[model samples]
Target: MKVVIFSTCVVDLEFPNVGKAMVEVLERFGCDCYLPSDQICCGQPTYNSGYEKGTQRTFRNQVDALLSVESDYIVGPAGSCVAMLREYPELLKDDPEYLGKARILAAKTYEFSQFLWRILGVENAGAELNGKATYHRSCHMTRLLGEAESPYALLEHVKGLEMVPLANAHDCCGFGGTFSAKEPEISKQMVDEKVRHIEETGAEILVSCDPGCLMNIGGRFNRLGKPIKIMHLAEVLNSNVDERRITYLKQMPV
Candidate 1:
């Protein structure tokens, strides 16, 4: 499949590895992924903060960068950015020109898991890594885009993955983009709960669909003392399966 990747500003700058991992996985899945050099922010922050007019200039540029490619879809590694683009049309209801573009972009825009499971129509992609994992259902993905099963469906077919359910899974990690800044104490409280759930699962890798949530919770895990390693969903799926096919002798739990 030919597609263009919409790398969010956060992933482009701070979490470049996430973007790189996304491309690697798509390539492995037989996709021709293209990146637009001029792509910038998805205007999420400003738009979410009731500054729709302020977001127009950036949104206009985003639409242009995405339309520059003649591909089947515009895929984004970050669920938040994809959801933002999908929501743009409603926010731009007053302007038909931009609204039309936003609707077109929304039609073609899809989150990673969405594209993999829906468009590609293959779950259990030929990846086998033997280990227990817990998936963090990102808020933007679950609440905004209503994409709940895509992540789980992908994990079900991972070469040797055992998905452990997260406790209180629907609760937010408190990292609603700038919401953490607006409410630090509450955000930290939510992170505490999320980390606590990861510990309960007894999983080595705590996987999440969004980098932003991982940033908040992972930072907290780094602060105190935690052994659990955090991984973006793309990174987990991008794992090199060459060595993972080997099974290790299990030690009986006492």
Candidate 2:
């Protein structure tokens, strides 16, 4: 099947390797994957901040970029961005020209975990990792995208891996994109609480599907000298016992 890698803006900028790791996992499954270089932000921040007009440009660009390749699926690593992509139909409903294309793009888009566990029927990508890891359920991935179970299902199949339940796994990491910047104090408090819970789990690593959350919580941990390693789900899934063990050790704050 033809798959388009819709690596969102954050992964493109800060964690480019995560996007590559995602492609690595996809290729392992024997799928032809193409990275759409011209793709930009899904206009989520602008749309969330009540700037509808600004969303149109990014929306149009993304629609044209993804639809240009007649692929079977457009898969992304971030749930929030994919959720925004899914909203394009409503965002452009009044504009008859792009409305149908928006819906088609929305229908074809799939979050990484959702595609792996649900669509691709891949519970195990034959990856192996030795760690007690906990997953932080990004709000958009769980509540908005309704993909609460796929990540866990995939994690369960990883050889030599131990998945633990995160306390208050559903709580927000206070990195609601602009929310962290707008309300630094509140965001700090929220992420601090999140870090505390993560520590309580006693897991060597904290895994999340969203880059924003990982950056926010990981930044707080870094400033406070917390040693916990923060990682993207794709990175973990693309790893083996030797690679993952070294990763955990290397990421430990010195």
| Top TM-score prediction, candidate number | 2
Prediction 1 TM-score vs. true? 0.90
The lDDT values for all models are 0.82, 0.84
For model 2, state the Cα shift of residue 197 in Å.
0.2
* Model 2 residue 201 CA deviation in Å: 0.4
lDDT per residue as tens, model 2, 73-171: 999999888988898898899989999999999998999988876677765566787888889999988888877887887777777778788888878
Q: Predict model 1's lDDT versus the native.
A: 0.82
CA RMSD of all predictions: 6.3, 6.6
Worst 10 residues of 1 by lDDT: 245-254
RMSD of 2: 6.6
